[model samples]
Target: MKYLLVQEDEEGVERLWGRCAGVEGLFVDPVPPPRETLTLRGCSPEGPLSEILAEPGVSFRGLGDMCVEVWDEEEPVQWWTLVDAVVVAHQPHPGDPARYDVVIGAGVRNEESFFDVPATPRFELLAGTTVAAARAGRCSSVDGLFAPRADPDPVPLELIGCEATEPLLVGTQRPRRWAGAWADLLVLDRHGAVMASCSVDLAVSEARPSVLGYGLEDITLTDGGTDRPSPAARGIWTEWYQGPPAAPNGWAPYDAQGRTAWLELTTRAWRGRASGPDRTGGAYHLDGRFVTDVPGLHCAIAEALLGPGRYFGREWNAFKDCLSGGFGVAPPFTLTWHESDVARDALADVVEDPEGQLSYFEETVQLLERCGVTVVLR
Candidate 1:
């Protein structure tokens, strides 16, 4: 099936954002139809299994995986749970060549965000998920699209029509900033092509507003506590998440404690001679080169790909150069930032000057693309 995410206005000039492929590696409880029984049935009392077996509805969950079995189906059925699961898809049925049949799935899990406040949280997928797919592209690993996690069953799904020229309404979402709230606008083409991507942020630096060009050396982030402006004049947050640095459970809150400074800003990019977004124009190629999740792997990837050229440690230019294929053996190569970054945006700016790193990344990514190398970091 093919899918696309787009942002269109009355002007009819649309933007292409990203694609979704059904390969997010998650097992979800598939909600059965209204009249159909989605839960497991025919339970008998065993000493310890009695309570579990007696429940009218059954959905089992675990640390990472979840599962459910239904023997009463037209055919026996099994389901697992997905996080931020695929909600809808356009599936092409066998013998049907001209039109696409939408393949939809039920959201089997019912877990609320530990925090009820909307859009402040993030998620992790065992395997990264693409919310939309390209034309004629295979939807791998994950099969059917799902409803929202909060809803156990599917709701009315409004999607763009299946025409490449039709503009669709992709969502307006926020990218995780190092601290506080910020968001970006993403626009995509009907066939899952990226048109234009942009964001709006506080743009503060050295007590001066980057966007408005005003200075606020005195104002700070204080929550009933005294403000302590620092090196760059931004105050350390007090009562950031309604409490101390850590939650009552003793775990560090995601937005607190300067943790975002250390977050790896991952990106997916290709740097090669003559390689197109379609992956054409070269015999020499390297693909799916994952920089493993291990201590110092960043340095390791830099050392391997850039040789003696510095990718990290020292300064920002070194990091940009290494990623842009300055030190790569390079004919053409596509590089991805692995899986974890998907849980949170890899581009939570940490540099006191937010765009210091942002602009360089943008510049380098565009330079690489113009040079026939494609880099993707969403």
Candidate 2:
């Protein structure tokens, strides 16, 4: 619950800025993707399609590229995408029992047409959305935009119950203009270990040297913004930040979103720590028991290479970057993936790729080999 605000210089010396008894809005929730309402008109879906729509709160994805292909009488029209599409309501067409009007809410459309098409198009549902699938206890991968809030607002962190040293409050007796200082806020757990951290611009609202608490005028994240964390997510974070040292696979208990949040926090906490010489040709072992999903695999990999609560990468591209060098280890290293069949089975779902659709496990193994990391599957 306590935080140490420190600034490290070029020489790696940490300068104490202040200390806070509490912090607010630190662990943010993943921003739900943008949503739009569309009416699927005059479509007579049969078999499982009707059953899927008849069910409530069931989300699904489209076919190739996970996009809904809009087709006319001759050829394909527009390929629309609904990241997480769920049926809101449906009704039979006024005159035809064979046709139905279904209104659904889904993530924003991928491609937008300038003008309306003259012909009516049909929608085909193919797969499951990452959000829905993950929530449904299915293994899913985190997309590029899945980590942060969609079209996020500016991140304003509030440091409550703060106290500063006299040297930090000398000129703040009067109402003078104060520009915020950029520093890293390290949240320490009960055992005085870093649980979470972030680089923030700290603007002092009131510098009370002796007071037990004073407010922070402004504290915003320097790196873009994020969606506000939900109450449930905040509760999950409280457990981690207030508990003892994070154990390996500690993030496995939570759902996909919660696991992703843990990875984000771990990623921030491990920033700047994965430095120094590359341990090239080192053989690291990745325990695959917890590698049920993409996010879980990332967490497991971090701990496998580094220690507990460490971070190597979040998604595939970042992993590729890490493989290049400077992330604890270099390429040409042998990674013996223990229990590799766990991931191979769990991540069997095919995902969208630049070349085409590929299973998550296949893509990951291919990426590791392509990046010069000798992947020894066990």
Candidate 3:
């Protein structure tokens, strides 16, 4: 999909810098937890296993290949325990060609080591084999295998398949200054509604003239600690961006993270639309049927106060900020929480937070009462 890179001026107006035909490094998997060594004692050599054992210094380096499958009653139970790397130091059991002790080296086992296995697990080798060269349409791997380990320090976002709309050599050259480099990457759908967004410091680190005018190889990302949407969430966004829902509460079917992402997009769309008298004494109706989680509560409350596709807050701290003023309402307002029983049953248990441990539903009600909000439960 094409990505439009735009910079916002002091007045908050967006200016187009360039467009990218394709982007890299936008969707990244979370760094896998480090692996430890394990010993598979008395593993019998059977069928193809004997052939694999015959190879000297046998290793399983393919993605997800170096793993011990856990089974509980003839059915596989746990399979995600992956080995980042493995080297087999095979030692045959004397006089028993059927029995073999498999010594797996460092970074080869996960939380459930061989000691935790209840049954002899099958070793899978079906994980796709690695390639020596990068796949087509993408640049070669920097470290010879896979994209360079996500830099410990923030790496610049890569914009591949880039093309300049105008002559890059003749247009006003953007200086490499932080003041001039700050920009936002706004991902918009066909109808121009923002689906996802993140701010970046856009100083170009590398570029080259290509058949498509110019290619921007590297652009610095400066929004520290901001989480990118997961690949699944992006799929939902792909459709929502093209055509938003006709009414409110369209985010009901999503998982917790996806629901949170929907709130983010809706919040952006709601900006500059809030208008009303001081909301100190106004009453709002909260449809509490969907208030099953922290994010879900925010979604319900935001829609209650302002219409659909609005934002009251994201988290506890942000909620407090919204209660102060200008989030389409002020405190000392009345909130009629319909179907409050659903939330009570859902969020009855306390969960840990930076502030303190408290049930989300309980804390929300308490916080509202403390802030001069009269809550009516029904």
Best candidate (score: lDDT): 2
User: TM-scores, in order shown?
Assistant: 0.21, 0.59, 0.56
Give candidate 3 regions above 4 Å deviation. Answer: 8-15, 21-25, 32-182, 200-226, 272-280, 352-357
Better of 1 and 3 by lDDT: 3
Per-residue lDDT for 135 in model 2? 14
lDDT of each: 0.27, 0.60, 0.56
Q: Write the per-residue lDDT of candidate 3 for residues 172-225, one digit (tens) a residue.
A: 144233233555666766765565676655545445453344444333333221
lDDT of 2 by residue, 274-317 (tens): 36887777788988987887788887887878767777888766
Compose the digit string of candidate 1's lDDT tens values, residues 192-291.
3332222322211112122212320111111111111222211212222121222121112233222211112111112112333332333322121231
| Residue 98 shift from truth in candidate 1, angstroms | 35
lDDT of 1 at 136: 17
Q: Could you tally the backbone clashes for each prediction?
A: 27, 3, 0
Q: Sorted by TM-score, highest first, which candidate order results?
A: 2, 3, 1
